[model samples]
Target: MEAFTTHTGRAVPLRRSNVDTDQIIPAHWLKKVTRDGFEDGLFEAWRKDEEFILNRPERQGATVLVAGPDFGTGSSREHAVWALQNYGFKTVISSRFADIFRGNSLKNGLLTVVLPQRTVDALWELTEADPTVEITVDLVARKVTAPGVEADFELDENARWRLLEGLDDISITLRHEEDIAAYEAKRPSFKPRTLTV
Candidate 1:
């Protein structure tokens, strides 16, 4: 996973509440075994509508997503996070997020910023008025800022550390490799085996 220190880019405003995982990436897209290529499936159903915000030419290449309340509220699908990341979104800003989806996003190095409804509304308006407006997310400072707008967002300390360090679960475990090896060497042979083999 790529480290998220600071990101500044145009934001795609998705002003719809209760955006479930299925809407972010349709269930049919989950058939793939690998994480790559899910970008084509991100918001597959919504993209069908030529009028959708994502289909707008001005919103093309947006790396930040400014969404409404209750974003990512639905089934526990990490693929939803994968789809967003693959689609070039490094951060998703919303007033609220489902617990499972937030966790998945953080684990995958996707920054999910929770701001007040008023702050989110202002961002949406700003983006709508000018698609070129750049939104900056500063993970080190725990802040999101845009033209004439700035707000602080909350993130778990551990998650923030992980992202800043670019450390995935495996990477974090590997940091303790030497200690694990030492512990294993001291283990008694009488200990029950975890695997039948």
Candidate 2:
């Protein structure tokens, strides 16, 4: 997983609520275990519609997604996060998110921002009014800011630190590899003698 620190980029405003995992990448796309190339499946169903937010060229390569409430609900597939990353979304801002989805997203280095409904609506409106509008997510400060809005938020200290350093769970554990090796070296290795019966 790539580390996340501060990201600033064009915003893609998705006003729909209750976007589930299946809608994110669909079940068929799950056949592949590798995380690469799932961008084709990101919002597969919605992308079919000519008017979907993602279909607009202005939103292409957008790194920040301003979405509605209850985002990433329904299923617990980590693929949802994978699809978002593959589709070039680095940060997701919404009024709320499913706990499991949020955890999965963080584990994959996708920053999920939880803000008040009013603030979310404001951002949605602002971005909609201007397709080129940009937003910034500052992990260190735990804040999301735009032209007229600045909202402070919270995240687990450990998660925040991990993202700032671009370290995933495995990378974090590997940081203590030397200590683990030393401990294993100190432990006595013994084989039990077989008892003749």
Candidate 3:
């Protein structure tokens, strides 16, 4: 996970609501064992329509997603987060997010910003009108900023710290590597070891 302090980029506005995980990345795409190739599968169904927001030439290369309410509100698949990240989205802005989806996104270093419905609407409008508009998500300041818009958001301090430090679950565990090693050294030879020498 890369440390996230602040990110400023153009956004892709997904106007539809209730965008579930399957729509983000269909179940068929989950067969892959690695994360990199999922980008091709991100919104695979939606990409079929040239009229889809994501298919618009102006929205190409957007790094942020300003989506409607109830975004990521279905199955608890981490692959959804992987698809977003793989598709070059660094942050996702919505009025609401499913608990599991939000958790998965944060763990994978994808910033999920929850804002009021009106605020999210404004962002969608702004991005839609001008695809070049740059929206900045500042984790350090806990706010989202764009031209004529600034909204404060709330995230627990621990989650904020983890993002700032680029510490995923594995990274957090590795921080106590020395302590773990010491404990393992003291274990009886007959005791079963979870990690091989």
Per model, state how many residue pairs clash. Answer: 0, 1, 0
Tens-digit per-residue lDDT, 1-197, candidate 1: 78889999999999899999999988898888998889989999889999999999999999999998999999998999999999999999999999999999988889999999999989999999999999999999999989899898888888899999988798679989999999999999899998988
**Whole-model lDDT per candidate:** 0.92, 0.88, 0.92
Per-residue CA lDDT of candidate 2, range 1-197, in tens?
68888999999988888878788889999889897889999999889998898999988878998888889987888888998998899999988998899999998889999999899988988999998888999998889989999999988898888788877687678989999999988877573448744
The superposed Cα distance between candidate 2 and the true structure at residue 183, in angstroms, equals 16
Error in Å for residue 114 of model 1: 0.4
Lowest lDDT 10-mer window, candidate 2? 188-197
Considering lDDT, which of the candidate structures 1 and 2 is the better prediction for this target?
Answer: 1
In Å, residue 100's CA in model 3 sits off its true spot by 0.7
Clashing pairs in 3: none
For candidate 1, which ten residues in a row score worst on lDDT? 166-175
Q: How many Å off is the CA of 134 in candidate 1?
A: 0.3
Per-residue alpha-carbon lDDT of candidate 3 for residues 1-197, written as tens digits (9 for 90 to 100): 87889999999988889999999999999888887789989999989999998899998899999998889988988999999998899999999998999998999899999999999889988887888999999999999999989999999999999999988688678989999999988998898769998
Q: Which runs of model 2 end up more than 4 angstroms from their true locations?
A: 171-197
